[model samples]
Target: MKGIKIGEYLVNSCTMYIEPVEYANKIYSHIVEVEEEFLSPFKPLQNIKNSCDYFGVDYESRRKGT
Candidate 1:
């Protein structure tokens, strides 16, 4: 498994999910673009609406509200 260095920890590309967490005393979340291989093996945002059955990942939106 390929991984990247983040400060002092090496984050692996094999990620199941990503969520917002406190960083530097701030409550926010963001994704970083790895210039080498790829950001991650799985992209939820793109995959969520990427394809109906592509890559064996079926993402369906059931509700919409704000």
Candidate 2:
């Protein structure tokens, strides 16, 4: 994001997702890191079911941003 580097890596500018309210009294969105290799819009979502299960997120729920 905006070439924000983590260590020696210059992260490429790319789309990012903001997950909200992961903590108490926090109304702001938090940056959720995406794998650099999967940043391309052309790439399919990796490990769909496992990710959803792990994250406790559903496809349509995520789609609606609810």
* TM-score against native, each model: 0.22, 0.27
Candidate 2 global lDDT: 0.36
- Name the runs in model 1 displaced over 4 angstroms: 1-13, 28-66
**What is the lDDT of every predicted structure here?**
0.36, 0.36
- Supply the global lDDT for candidate 1: 0.36
Q: Which residue runs does candidate 2 get wrong by more than 4 Å?
A: 1-49
lDDT of 2 by residue, 1-66 (tens): 232322111122442553333234333333335643222211123333334556677766765774
Q: For model 1, what is the alpha-carbon lDDT of residue 64? A: 48
Candidate 1 on 2-58: residue-level lDDT in tens? 334232112335434333444456433233434442222333344334333444533
